[model samples]
Target: MDLHSALIALRDPMGIPFFPWLFQGLMVLTFALHILLVNLVVGGIFLAVYHHVKGGEYGRKLSKTMACCSTVNLSLAIVLGVAPLLFVQVIYDPFWYTANAISAWWAMVFLLVITLGFLSLYVFYLKREKHPSGFGFFGLFALVMVVFAGVIMSMFAMQQLLPEKWLSWYVVKGSLQTLGGGFHAFSLGRFLHFMVPAFVNIGIYMMLYAWYFRPRTDFDQGYLDWIGKSGVRLAKIAAMIQVVIGFWWLFSTPIKFGFYRNPVFLIGAVLGFLVMVALIMVQKDPERYAVPMGIVSLVAVLGMSAAREVLRMGYLGQFDYSIYQYPVNLDWGSTVLFLVTFVMGLVVIAYPITLVFKLGRGTLSVEEG
Candidate 1:
């Protein structure tokens, strides 16, 4: 069968449970949240390890802070990832499932790798007090595992864009390649495009961190000043690198697609540039601009996520596929339940989130004492 026919055949015959647009929108929103926490996890751990090795008074303190935050953010990242994964599977089952099948072994091993990454991070976090510099290796190992997991995920995402190559990857030469051990395609530019922003986001997080703890009697004014300066500097540098990488990835795309001219992509690029400009402006006073810039940065991330979805649409469009054209079974019951559950989840988590914030600021302890 031809590629188009095979794709159609692979799609769920029962049709999707709701409108494709709704799922697509939710996918982008949830993906932004997932990726935000993911950036925190990856960048936080890297900073933790870096500071641990360069131990001094403030460095050790920051290292411990990041080590704790990475564990929490990693958990949230994993949890938030479910919604986007489900939405993508719902709307792009043909591509999503096929990509997984292509690298079935990696898909299966992904869980183990992530688990090891999590444990390795904990080892670094829990053992740092006893063997501060020596345990840096654990943090480094965790970073490698986390990055490798991203590599696997990026490979799968890129694979989904190239349906035409599926058959060849599945049937190498005359023999069937059922072991699914091969990584058939990867786009380093695209992967780095996603990754380089980790430092940017984490830097912004650090600025907010400084601002959040400014009122704390226990937090040194000098340390806060140092964090604010370091954060803005890191953010500015990373944002600049991100801009260059963005253009590199853009130019690497098929010229025929003309993604550079695509309105959605252009808007995303503009938002990214605005973020860099905002980062630059905040360098003089990151603490004062922390909240506003954080909001802008998130909005920019959401815009970029939308642009990512648009790019995916462009890729699948080459195969005459559109989620809008997908069969809809119209299951309002499940849709409503999903929405209700999502809202309830936010409500449930709000208490702990607020408590954590207060604890970080020492307000909770002050009140109790």
Candidate 2:
């Protein structure tokens, strides 16, 4: 069979344990959460390094807080990443496994890269007190490692969608080399498409950080104002750049005409605009509007994720493969169990995060409103 036909002929190894749509829904939901933390980690680390290099009292505090947050966010990103991957493997086994085989070494080394990156960040945090120069070097090195890992994953994800080019990519060395770790195909626009959001989300997060702790803590008012304004400035610049990049990314992709006519695309674009508008509105009273602004930002993320899936499916449509086309083999017992555990796991994770904030608030004297 030809490559395209072979890919289409591939069946679910698990024999369709449940409705494919269910897995698709779960993937989108879990992926949305996963990407949020990803933004936090990637953007938090960069911001930490940026603030640290600027070298002042408030900059040091911001840098320290972001470094600490990056540690937690990285861990959460790993944990939350599993669900969507599970769903994707179940639905797109042939494509995913093929991409892995093409660059098996890189796929295997991805975990090692993350491990080293994590350790580097941890050491940076620990050594920041005793050795400032060491911290700077480690911070910059760790950022590159983390960003490299992200690039590897993004390449793999996008590659699976282009099964037509798989064999050509795999044979670029004039032989079928399964262990070649080089990137065969990637788009700068698409990479930036994901990377740009990291800044926008982290910027909003910083603003929220300043807003929440401002009244509850005895932090210097000048420092609080500086942090909040810094966040606003970051959000405005990154978000504006993201919009331009969004257009570039959209035009670069092989999107269907119908998708452009779809409400999902339109709604996602509108939400993106409104997120910027909402961020602008919060300049007067960031503390008061922080929660509402955050809610809107998440909605925007969720909407864009949905739109992305739509575009992905539209691409796969050319191959006559749709997740919905997979047969159903309902197994309610396991499904219920999985759902129950997922919710409980979220609750458990949320408690400590809440406690950290509570303790942080208690650490500072409340600013009289």
Candidate with top TM-score is 1
Question: Residue 146 CA error for candidate 1 (Å)?
Answer: 0.4
Model 1 lDDT per residue over 305-368, tens place: 9888888888988888888988999899988998899899989999999988888787786556
RMSD of each: 1.6, 3.1
**Candidate 1 TM-score over all chains jointly:** 0.96
- Return the lDDT, model 1, position 100: 95
Q: Model 1: which residue pairs collide?
A: none
Candidate 1, residue 218: lDDT: 81
TM-score of 2: 0.92
* Candidate 2 local Cα displacement, residue 230, angstroms: 1.2
For 1-369, candidate 2 gives per-residue lDDT tens digits of: 776578767766456788888888888888888888888898999988887788788888888888888998999998889978898899878878877887788887888899999999998777785664457777777788888988888888888888888878878669876666757667778778778889888988877887777765467878777777888778867888888887887788875646766788788878888878777777766656767778888988888778878877877778887778776778889989988998898799897877776677665235621
Q: List residue ranges in candidate 2 displaced over 4 A.
A: 2-4, 171-174, 255-258, 347-357, 363-369
Against the true structure, whose lDDT is highest?
1
